[model samples]
Target: MTDPCGACGARGCEELFHGLLALDHSRAEPWGPLHGVSVSCFLLQHPARLPADGGAAARGLLRAYLDGGLPAVDRLIGRARAANSHRVTGRSAPGGAVPPGREAPRGGFAVTVEEVAQDGTFPAAGFPDRVRAWAAATLEVWGPVSP
Candidate 1:
């Protein structure tokens, strides 16, 4: 029940989406950290969800990565923090600090950026390449993809 291209994993497609991929609420990565975030905006404005709630979730997610161990590989915190900052406040968090009350589950902290610019562009420079490297490492563990 692996992916047809062998990129996702040995698990079934349904399993990957429905059961797994919860982004580890525990933040204790006994296995490892995720490769990279899939850059896309989700509609959290539905009746069941609200923007404020979504903001909280964003901070929580950021906490996981900032405190997680998988980042020991490449530490893509600059871009990750920026992404989190913009998500939480619609403004930049200069230090990439996870918002108050949302502490990272792990003891480690994110690699802080010297400064954050308000140029309106989301990710910092070289983010896409970092994403690729993360993906490459992930795919290597999952197995090769087909042409």
Candidate 2:
């Protein structure tokens, strides 16, 4: 088998991803608002899986959700979709480079998919709470986004 993911140290990321997808489809209601959170956290951890624009967008979306809840996240997503851009506004400066002040941490996040999975498998009771905590903790490691 392949080694664990370098970023998140997940042993079986593909399986985890599949589980996440199942949870997303099976528990859409509770998972809807928090889906972005989970996605952002995963993308941020596995930065190589994302391009520069995607990384910035993930950071921006996660920050917005932390600061303004669902409405803020929705607004950012709406704007990106409307503009046909893959970035979250204010997350990337021009040309898809992450702004200096908003860069991800040099090492890694304190929390990751492992922690989220610690609560149990996806679609299990209280899984949403684990994801919420993972998002919050991961964002905490990234610190506050600069304006």
Candidate 3:
């Protein structure tokens, strides 16, 4: 069936994809639904499922935009790199391998800032509003949200 909200729409989704692409494996996984729209974070975390570099870059930008800069952005980046990040993965049901097209659920990416850290402050200045504006722009480019 066609995606009810055209979940596969190519516009804003591209931005989202890019956002995912740029994310190093260290960021928080907000892999769940936010108001019915799914942010496919879990998919991006799997080595086999990671999007291409270009896509990853876009996703990185989106992620950076969303999560806000950490108090120590450079330090976090260093830690993540030094750790030699691992692709996140999870096993399927007992004795069940992951299905080809149905790996992780679709709703695991779109995290809010609070969910990503204990410190309740933004990284870059003027962040939260910027993210909101970015998301709104994406939604506008994609189409209006469904009721």
Candidate 4:
């Protein structure tokens, strides 16, 4: 299905984006490398609040999804994906996956491994310092945004 929004069967992307829209401001984490592979971290935010127009669209989309609006957002997302892919380099961005043995994100298994960047491999002197640096960085980027 083709959509004006440019998605490609990635409901998680829309869900994450939608969650961002719900907040007044939001911050998304940078995708990081794990075991030599890039992995998306759980998105974090303060509170969902939106500007007037954005709020309206978010609400409408949320309602539609809750009301069984299927295939519609999928089309919009398709369009979005097409547009994004066209603009990006040949490398397709990796989407999220249900990591084996890890509980489903929606199944009360949402977890955040803070201070993970502090491992011995971290550029910092120690794990603690690296974790502090990571937290500081996260706050700096988010800038009081809900995400």
| Per-model TM against the reference | 0.25, 0.72, 0.25, 0.20
Candidate 3 lDDT: 0.32
Q: Which stretches of model 1 miss by more than 4 angstroms?
A: 1-11, 35-69, 72-74, 83-147
Q: Per-model C-alpha lDDT, please?
A: 0.29, 0.66, 0.32, 0.29
Clashing pairs for model 2 are none
> What lDDT tens digits, residue by residue, belong to model 1 across residues 1-147?
243313222224233322223432333342113322311001111112224342333333333333453353235455556577644656432222223554222211111010111121213354334433433332223222221
Worst 10 residues of 3 by lDDT: 31-40
**42-68, model 4: which lDDT tens digit per residue?**
231111222323222232222222233
Candidate 2 TM-score, true structure as reference: 0.72
RMSD of 3: 13.8
Q: Over 4 Å off in model 4, which ranges?
A: 1-49, 52-54, 75-147
Residue 99 Cα positional deviation in candidate 2, in Å, after optimal superposition: 5.3
lDDT score for residue 48 of model 1: 24
Best by lDDT: 2
> Best candidate, TM-score-wise?
2
